[model samples]
Target: MKKFFSISFVLLLALSGILAGCGSDEAGGEAGKKIKIVAAHNQTSPDNPYQTGLLEFKEVAESKSNGDIEVEVHAGTIGTEESELVEKLKLGAADVVLVSPGFMTQTGIKEIDLLAMPYLFDNYEHWEKTVDGEVGEEMAKLINEKSNNDFKLIGYWSAGVRHYYGKKPLEKMEDMKGLTFRTQTSGVVADYWKKVGAIPTSIAWGELYQALQQNVVDSSENSYPYFVQQNHHKTDNGKYITETAHDYTTRFLLVNGKKFDSYSKEQQDIIIEAAEASVKAEREAVYAQEDEYKEKAIDDGAKVNEIDREPFIKLAEPLQEKAAKDMGAEDLLEKIRNLK
Candidate 1:
């Protein structure tokens, strides 16, 4: 598997070079020429919030610009992996894409990972307050400047709130002890789960169904819409869900900054306006899906239980502080904490 992944990375690198060379040498030139922005996301599901958001962007931009701007949206057709999509964005093969902060951190700007830290927000409101506020602005600046303006964060979206689903319900923190839980294998997520006595196991998103079915991992965590959409609730090991709500997942709608810089001032304003619409549409879709999917999970014979998440939140504070300090975002973390 390691060897396969290594080869995939090499091929993607080669593809990035080819894509960079294939595009017009001048990206943001000649405003009158019909400009096509290739927007992509790795999610194949048409109902996904990412697709909804990207389609909103396409519709608003094309209509408002009167076809001066053509937005071609691809759902998992261009690249089925976010890493590849990010590479395409930098190379100008893809003009815009969605990604989590964890992937952003891999670009060598550690501060972006601050948003991915679990339990940082008390709820969706607190999460929004931080990301839609000065912290979000500062992080956007950091991402653009650090990537040499390769990435411009246009908007923030959510994957709803994440909770735990497993073969058994976690009634208390001690219930996680000795169970192998599939989650992020490194960073603050793993640290928090590990401190709770659950072993953190890394599994590819695509392979998680089989992993859970075969008991390769005893438990896993994700938002209601995501796991239920995948039919994970039907699996033997995925039937019991605990509302940990440990994370209010954040995703970034990012465009190629250098390419965006090349656009006419009017074009830039329209694109930003479209992004605002996309953000609103995406959040509404996700919030609605959370309740819809949770009900569907119950109707499908999957059990749901609520936990007193206060203890979990307490456990996360020190972890959040450590993560922020490590990433040099102590003040930003404090700001997020106070927003609650």
Candidate 2:
């Protein structure tokens, strides 16, 4: 009887130890569970390229991880302006954000602003070559260094080229004279518009339609897709399209340095792969839709004109020279110009 009791006690002790070990393992596994990421953008819907790319990222990240990671999109919910978005990204309030190169000027990478200079590229191919080549890599490196390890640029997505639209047909730069044109608050953009003899007026994108309806502004410039998507053509306040192609706007997919560092090496690789895939998909989509949007604008009563691009290009020469001398972007501009 004594032996039986001793043996039973020993067995109970072993069983308890096994159960305790299992509990610890379960707890550790739970603690090590999936990583969650939030991607923020100014896009309000999935229809836009920025939002679509982010959605693709979410799908690829989650699907590829087999449920080990999750990405939530905070489109147009975090902030309305680019500056605000950058601030949120730096403060770590946002894990990821889609920002324009224009905003990088504040970080001492003023050279990026020169990319927005009017009529910089002769065609989309030239634009792509410059961005995908050494110049783009250098700019990215400069941005990373200037950011002080707060943000990492994952990829660049197209915002397309901006063209002018107005109520009256503008056949030449002189036709833009005295027109109250809606302009971004960018000093370079404002100066460009001023030099072209138009009155540059600053208006938030959300308020543009109302501003147009009330005759607050007579004209604006943007990519054809944006103009079409925003229903600016329907306003009937403007019907002329100029082939100015002033800016080849681009947005960056940036990640929080701290949040990215927390992920395992395998997880980081997966996220970057997903981001690159989404960027390729987005570029294809934008190029496919570019002409479609232009046709749609014409069908909707907007008069499309293929003006002499050379004159506008010549007009922009002074601005480029001024930017080179005063803005310290001459080297970057020269690099882009030298690209074959």
Candidate 3:
């Protein structure tokens, strides 16, 4: 009887040890466990800058962690809309996501809308200086705090420079009068277009090709890589290209802050490094693709023209001031302007 009791106690101890080991693994113990990250972007094009950026992130993260951290990049796989991506990230369905300022504002981070203001940035050099500097840091902090750490801004990305394309070319600001423009129909972007005498209209990015082809909208605006890849310039309503040079665009690369905090310090470090690499790779891709796609559009018979931008700049200034004051980002606006 004594021998039997001793054996039973020993078995109980072993069972407890096994349960504890399982608990540790479940609690993010690095031993014998691999971390999986779901990184996503809305653009589905294989040659897209977003894809290049996220893949670079995957490579750096996996290689640096020696395969301990596995990054699975989904390009329009899990979510094709920025809104969907933002929702997934907040719900913990996605670990990392790329989103635009317009959608980010929809998530209750209104300060981000500042980045989407038309004519806010003069050129890519000015944009890089602002976002990689103090203004960017402030914005990131605001995002993390405003979202209660649900979002952590990991990096800033560009969607290249936006231009105007439509059925007809604009020789001056007055030419935009009475034109139905496809663009953000809300916020400062809409206000700017309206002030310039164009009627702002909202359309989904996916449906835009059909809209352009069918002449459902009279005109639209976007960067070269984006509209060109969609063959927008080939459409009857999209054949004319004017270098409006509005919106040196900005995209946010975000990770779930709560999830980031839960990771081991080493894992967090690897993620930051990966983000840095992605920013570099993505920007280079956009710059190169912009020139390539612009040339492609011209070769395909898309009319290309350049106009004096002083009129557009003049129109955007008052709106910028009013928007900055309303958002309580007057100081940030001043800083961005000073950079320019």
Model number with the top TM-score? 3
- lDDT pick, better of 1 and 3: 3
Among residues 3 or more apart in sequence or in different chains, the pairs in candidate 1 whose N, CA or C atoms overlap within 3 Å are none
Ranking by TM-score: 3, 1, 2
Write one digit per residue (lDDT tens) for candidate 1, span 92-133.
Answer: 999999988877887998998888887877777777777776
Where model 3 places Cα greater than 4 Å from the true spot, the runs are: 1-32
What's the residue-level lDDT of 3 in candidate 1?
9
Please rank every candidate by lDDT, starting with the best.
Answer: 3, 1, 2
TM-score of candidate 3 to 2 decimals: 0.90
Candidate 2 displacement at residue 14 in angstroms: 55
Full-model lDDT, candidate 2: 0.72
Tens digits of per-residue lDDT, candidate 2, 18-104, equal 223333423322433598887888756456777778888889888888888888888788876777888888888888788877776
Candidate with better TM-score, 1 vs 3: 3
Model 1, which residues run further than 4 Å from truth? Answer: 1-28
TM-score of 2: 0.85
